[model samples]
Target: MEAEFKDAEIFKRMMDATGNLMSDVSIDFNEEGFAIKAMDPANIAMVLFEAKNSIFSSFNIEKPIKISVSLDDLNGILKLVKKDDKLKISDSKNKLVLDIRGKTKQHFTIPLIDENYTAQKIPQLKFTAEVTVLSSLVKDSVKAAALVDDSIYFTVDMPRLIISSKSEEKEFSQDLSINDNKEIFDMKSESTTRSKYSIEYLTKFLYSADSEKPIKLSFSNNYPLKLDYEINSDAKMSFILANRLE
Candidate 1:
């Protein structure tokens, strides 16, 4: 089997996103494309990734396969690819090979990591509130929260999305009003919802995404927060973060 990515940057972004939460991942390659569903070692955060076959310039497969590899290993090679380089990938008994071709050529191989854990199945959660806002908005909020504490409180209402954090030393909070910014494209709620999450994990996800892209968020009081973003034209990635229990 051989696969080619027209834009290596997209694959790099996906790796960056997963690497933030996990060191190793079991990636499934099928006719549909590539998908990964994994939980952080601490089981505090879950990440789901899906990139459709259409997104790749060329994708060929005889049968579906699952490969375990270190996110750091793949990211390392992708970082070396030139802006216009097309990425070609292959796998063998115990290693994955990457060929980066553009004005110049580069080749690298990484030993596959052995994975013993099974992929997790995420449930369909019903959230009381939902909102779509620019990724930069939440990214900035997390940055502010990090200055004060390790966790941030997300308070979502019909008219606003509030982020707050406090520690013994200082407190910080930011209210993102719904009506003012066009970046807040859509919002709906039967009632208000609030939850606290680790700013560290939230920043991991945010930093991997495009600042201008829209992020759809869903949550309920004291429940896990869900964040979704379009990885590309045909791919989408989501994260489910366990709420901080006080």
Candidate 2:
């Protein structure tokens, strides 16, 4: 397996997303694309990473391979690469090679692979409404809600979207409306659906956005929320954050 990236920062960002809730991940590299899936120990959240040929500057895999690795170790190794240096990874048996151009190459030996766990398939969520919103606005809502409680309430009404959280001592709410031009696209709400989710998990998901690019949100009452961040024109990365009702 050989892959190259022009900037190491992009690689760091992808690894950071996995480190939030997952310690280890099962990554599959095939002709179709690259995919990673891992569940938190408590089973409350799941993080997914995906990058396709269109997203990467250069993506080439002679054969498919699946490996389970400690995310922290990978991140640590990736950090060694300088800003402009290219990064490459190749696996053989129990050893992994980390190559940094214009610098000393490093080979890190990890534990033997354990192929015992099964990959959980993300369910096809049937959402009543889907909305497209700016990443910054979503990040702000999560940050504001974090001050009061660990959970946030997401409420979407056509032409307006609201994220609110309250505790016995304090309350906070963020409202984005079509009239204000903050919300880029608002879909008609089929039914008034509200659900509570962990602020930490939602915040991590928000960071997956590359820029002010639109994120697709799908949700149902008391059901898991799906947030998708499109990487390049052809690739997308998503997170399935479970709900904790208020």
Candidate 3:
């Protein structure tokens, strides 16, 4: 089996984001496309990544396969990728081969892990509130919260959404409303809902998002936070973060 991605940058970004939470990952490659599902070491967060065959420039596979790899090793090579570099992936004996094409052709092989891959079951969550806002706003909110505490609170009161953090001596807040904040495209809430989540996981999730694009947030009072980002028409990433209960 062999596959060629349309944009090496996109592939690199995807791996970089996932690596923030997980060091080892199993990638499932099939006729349709490829998918990756992983949970953070502490099990506080989970990430789901999927890319359709359409997202790849060329994909040739006779059968479905799952290859486990070390993100550190893979990312080490990807970090050297130039702007115009192209990437093709294939499998060799107990190893994953990376063929990078650019000014010169290069091949790098990394050992594949020998282990059984178990699929993680995504929690079925029902959210009372949903909001679509510019990704940059969410990223900034997380950054601000990091200065005060390790966790942040997300509150929704009708048309308004508030991101805040508090500690013994520090407090920070950023407010947005559908009617007033131009960056907030839409917001809906059944009632006043609030939840707290770890800022570290939030930052990792936002790393995969395009700051200029929009991201959807779903949550309920003291429930898990569901953040959805669309990389393109054929690719998507979703994150579920368990609430940091007080």
Is 1 or 2 the stronger prediction by TM-score?
Answer: 1
Give lDDT tens digits, candidate 3, residues 1-246.
Answer: 799988888788889998999888888899999888877888889888898998789999999999899999999999988887899999988999999999999899999996544688888899999999999999999998999999999999978899999999999998888899999988999999999999988988998799999999999999999999888878888999999896
- In model 1, where is the ten-residue run with the lowest total lDDT? 114-123
Q: Please provide TM-scores, in order, for all candidate models, with all chains considered together.
A: 0.95, 0.88, 0.96
Alpha-carbon local distance difference test for all models: 0.86, 0.74, 0.90
Which of the two, 2 or 3, has more TM-score?
3
Cα misplacement distance, residue 96 of candidate 1 (Å): 1.3
lDDT of 3 at 186: 87
Highest lDDT: give the candidate number: 3
lDDT of 1 by residue, 16-69 (tens): 888888889888999999998898999898988899898788888889988889
Q: Which scores higher on lDDT, 1 or 2?
A: 1
- The local lDDT score (0 to 100) that residue 32 gets in candidate 1 is 97
Q: Pick the TM-score winner.
A: 3
Backbone clashes counted, model 1: 0
Please list all clashing residue pairs in model 2, or write none if there are none. Answer: none
After superposing candidate 2 on the true structure, give the runs of residues whose Cα lies further than 4 Å from its correct spot. Answer: 55-60, 103-112
Q: Which ranking of candidates, highest TM-score first?
A: 3, 1, 2
lDDT of 2 at 68: 74
